[model samples]
Target: MGLITPIGFFSIVQKPSDRTHDTLTVRARMRGDLAALK
Candidate 1:
């Protein structure tokens, strides 16, 4: 039970970290494209 709780917490934390990373990557690419357009 103790181990499972920590693992579950880690998974929850990891999920958002992954999403934020992906969002940053996409935003960076979009910013680069916009700069090129100008």
Candidate 2:
């Protein structure tokens, strides 16, 4: 239980940042594609 607690906390803290990074990356890619299309 003790070891699991830290792992769970780590994942909770990490997930949002990971999601934000992925979102930014996707948006940047989309913008680049739009610019290329123009």
Candidate 3:
């Protein structure tokens, strides 16, 4: 039960972190494209 609890918590934490990382990467890419266009 203890091990499973940590695993579940980690899985929940990982999802949002992954999403934020992807959003930041996409924003960075868009900014780079705009800069290149200029």
Residue-level lDDT of model 2, residues 1-38, one tens digit each, is: 11233213211133566786764222223344435434
Give the per-residue lDDT digits (tens) of candidate 3, residues 5-25: 321311113346678666422
Clashes of each: 0, 0, 0
The CA lDDT of each predicted structure is: 0.33, 0.34, 0.33
Off by over 4 Å in 3: 1-29
> Which residue ranges in model 1 land beyond 4 Å of their true spot?
1-29
Can you list the residue pairs that collide in candidate 2? none
Give all TM-scores, in the order shown: 0.23, 0.23, 0.23
In candidate 2, which residue ranges exceed 4 Å CA deviation?
1-29
**What is the overall TM-score of model 3 with all chains considered together?**
0.23
Q: Write the per-residue lDDT of candidate 1 for residues 1-38, one digit (tens) a residue.
A: 11233213111133466776664222223344435434
